[model samples]
Target: MAVQTYSGSCHCGNVRFEADIDLAEGSGKCNCSICSKTRNWSVSVKPEGFRLLSDEQATTDYQFNTQSVHWPFCRTCGVRAYGHGDIPEVGGKFVSISVACLDDVTPEQKAALAVRYADGGNNNWWNEPSDAEKQYL
Candidate 1:
């Protein structure tokens, strides 16, 4: 599938970004604590594939588990607009951009891409859950 550029922002528009993604490739939904709680619908891209247009101070970071991921949320509205993490298999770093925040995509448009559900809750039914993190699109 061809890569396309898309724009997005936080609920209060405090955090904004642009991402180059191939929507046909789909995104991810994990039943992990943070994911399920936040209703995150996200897709991954390399650092270069994403650009944060807002001031870095507009967002706050929250992390758990192995603390490998830096989940960023809008300080004003508490919206988790995006996240950064590492996937050694693909690259040294990656960004998990929220499909829900895509300005041009409707719920249907976002849903059009096949979503792969990870059993994060079950896979992480322990203190250490890194071994269960997903490694896919």
Candidate 2:
């Protein structure tokens, strides 16, 4: 799919954002602790493709392990709307938009998109894990 702008928000609607994403580029799931726990399904986009449509102070950030990624969520609803980090593999600064939080994307559209799995639990960002490992991720 071509790049398109998507609007999204947290459960309480206190945190809202917009991002331009191309689902054909694929979304990702990671076995990293936070991702696994949150069941984060996301797509990456350059910082320019993302916009915070609400007050930045309405969100809170959480960082762990390497503390490289900043996961921001709505303070009122505790829904992780998106995350930001510097990943050389993805150019430089990038935003990881939560696919599930997208308000305009239908379930059918999300199901049809390609998904990639990462073995972030083991710190292997560049390698795809075994099929068996992917099952649980």
Candidate 3:
């Protein structure tokens, strides 16, 4: 897949970031409580591939479950542009960038994305999002 740089930020622009992403690789949406409530649409980018352009102090953290993921929201705008967490498989941390926050992608680009809905609401992250994939197809 080809690579592209995406710049995004919170609704109020208090929290911002840039990431190198391949939109063809698709993105993720979870049925988890917070996600379901916020309708978060996201793509994963490695630490090196992601850059935060805003002050860390501009955001506030909210966590649940095992507290592995830190859901940061811009205090001023109440928008969660991204989330941070460590992955056991990668032996490192990762950033989940909100696709809706992206400033440059066109609506067509967004519509073309293949999204997988994880059953995170049930803690069944191990299983493939089969039903959701089928629906998209």
Best-matching candidate per TM-score:
2
Off by over 4 Å in 2: none
Q: Candidate 2 at 6: error in angstroms?
A: 0.8
The best-first sequence of candidates by lDDT reads: 2, 3, 1
- For every candidate in turn, the CA RMSD to the true structure comes to 5.4, 1.3, 2.8
Question: Against the true structure, what is each candidate's TM-score?
Answer: 0.83, 0.93, 0.88
Name the top lDDT candidate: 2
Residue 46 accuracy (lDDT) in model 3: 81
Tens digits of lDDT, candidate 1, 1-137: 68989999999999999999988888887778888787777898889999999999998888888898999889999888899998575468999988889898777777588877766677643232343454421
Superposition error at 18 for model 2 (Å): 0.9
TM-score ranking of the models:
2, 3, 1
lDDT of 2 at 115: 86
lDDT of each: 0.82, 0.89, 0.85
Winner by lDDT between candidate 3 and candidate 2: 2
Q: After superposition, which runs of candidate 1 have C-alpha atoms over 4 Å from their true positions?
A: 89-91, 124-137
lDDT of 2 at 94: 90
Model 3 score (lDDT): 0.85
